[model samples]
Target: MYPISTPSHAKLLRPSALPLHDRGGGARTVALVSPALGATTFISGITEFDPGTEIPFHSHNCEESVVLFEGDAVMDIDGREYALQPLDTTFIPANVVHRFRNVSHSKPMKILWTYASPQATRTLRDNGEIRAVALEHGKQ
Candidate 1:
């Protein structure tokens, strides 16, 4: 077996999946870190929010936790809005509506997010669409 880390060294995490997000502003994504296979736990690397950027409203089929690192933003979950700042943590349950926006004039917001399942993190990123939003919001 190939050794990963030493007994005293911390384990390393690296992700090998990429998803599409063509919303607003510049959305550059880095897998940052994730293990190849996890038995029952999921981890996040570093997800950044560009200035004046907002992820459209959507929900996951699994539980997710997000911790904000810097800049200003807001998270709307289940018809409730929560202002976000550095070091803030929020939880969003399965199948509950949620969205995030960076309303800051300057500085980018970084969120160290976590999901209960491996595929949950990419659900919103890969599946969200504008045509459906317009239909759901009755703007069409």
Candidate 2:
């Protein structure tokens, strides 16, 4: 972990300066704050979704909060779907199956997400594959 005791440890992150990792099906993510960046309690990042794209249903080992930043989206929690607008926020409990889908066919959607743990992990509902959340963005 990077040292946090000095002012030099502070980081200024710009999404444009980070690499976006493809999550498949037009979804991509950029991990911002994480253990790889000296964050110990939580991890955060932004995800951009192409029109009509959605991530696979998955669950996390820790609680997650997402705030919509652009375009319209649908939040799928378990088997139910909820419409979301710009600035809409959601708090999802640990182990709850959820996903975000961009509803527009010609526009993009983006969200800022934060996970409660530095060691968060995602488990795909389809094949039970697990991945470290930070690593998902190539941060570690």
Q: Give the candidate number with the greatest TM-score.
A: 2
User: What TM-scores do the predictions have?
Assistant: 0.68, 0.90
Model 2 segments beyond 4 Å from truth?
1-8
- What are the lDDT scores of the predictions, listed in order? 0.60, 0.89
Pick by lDDT: which candidate is best?
2
* Residue 20 miss distance in model 1 (angstroms): 13
lDDT of 1: 0.60
Report per-prediction Cα RMSD to one decimal.
8.2, 2.9
Q: What's the TM for model 2?
A: 0.90
**How good is model 1 by TM-score?**
0.68
Give the per-residue lDDT of model 2 (tens digit) for 1-140: 32233577788787887777997789899888888777889999999999999898999999999999998899999679999989999999999999989999999999999999999999999999999988887777
